[model samples]
Target: MPEKRRPGGNTGVWWRLIQTAARAGEDMFVAPDARSVHRGNRRAPRTEVFRPCLVGRPGGDPDREIWEGIVLDLNRYGFRIRSFAPFVEGDLVTVQLMRDEEFKYPLSGVLTARVVRRSEAGGGLMDFGMELVVEPLSPTSRSGRGIRPAPPPSLSRPGTRMHLADYISKGRGNKNR
Candidate 1:
């Protein structure tokens, strides 16, 4: 039997409808950012940061070499940093949070954290999510007594500011004295 053709040529109505639906779906459902995927109901809350930081790994030797990074977010135990240097999961790292002009807080020490996740940020840079292998002890804990008091547990809470003494750094690596 011969096939019958439509009165006019196929304008691709079905294809057009599918395309339109796909476009609508794309618009309605946007993909979440890299941070969103890793930080699902985190045990510790993270606060957005604009502070400059140094993230370094052992370079050939145990001595730590620095890489410039912007601390995107931080908690007491971990941090999410963006840097041009790439770090792989389970890699150990050290961090030094540079003093900001606005806050003027000096924080530096060997973190000894394990990289939990690494996501590429555009422009040859990557974002790293690090979890501290061991929670840093307050300076006072080492000295037995410190002149400064410890800051409140929550850094993200409104009206709470971080103090120089509040910064935690623990364990000595070959890089750090």
Candidate 2:
């Protein structure tokens, strides 16, 4: 005896439903952008930026050759900069935002910071995580000058740091930082 087929073949309908669900079950979640992956607990939210800046030694000298850098991102306590200069961790660097009329955000005049993280940004360039050792930069808004802030406890000794692995192992590289 031949097996019976349901009315207009409900099997095809059931199969199509399974197929649709299988397609839906696939990994369709969008991946997050690496640049905007800032976890909570930040003192201030990061502001996306493409401002030009000069990274140099922490001095008021006007005759020092400085590394030309572009501010990739900015925040209250820190910002990220990309430059060709191979600045080492714990190095004291000064970052001065260029006075561009097209891109002005009132963060003028030298910012002293410590190189917290270093990452290869391809093309012989590097990305430096700058943590502002100085804040509230100017005594007056229009002064555009800042008195350098003392280094935090960890970077008190400039040009001195343990290996990256060692530093991370000690939990200094936590998300909070």
Top candidate on lDDT is 2
lDDT tens per residue, model 2, 28-55: 2233563442222345667889888888
Model 2: lowest-lDDT 10 consecutive positions: 23-32
Q: Quote model 1's TM-score.
A: 0.49
lDDT scores in order? 0.70, 0.75
- Clashes (backbone N, CA, C under 3 Å), per candidate, total 0, 0
lDDT accuracy of residue 79 in candidate 1:
82
Q: Encode model 1's per-residue lDDT on 1-177: one tens digit a residue.
A: 998878765667666556645554222112476333222235666788877877788455756567888889888878888988667998988777888734245577545778887888888999998887786688768777766766769756567876644454223333342
The C-alpha stretches of model 1 lying farther than 4 A from their native spots are: 1-39, 58-64, 100-106, 135-177
- How far out, in Å, is residue 68 in model 1? 0.5
TM-score of each: 0.49, 0.49
* Candidate 1: clashing pairs of residues: none
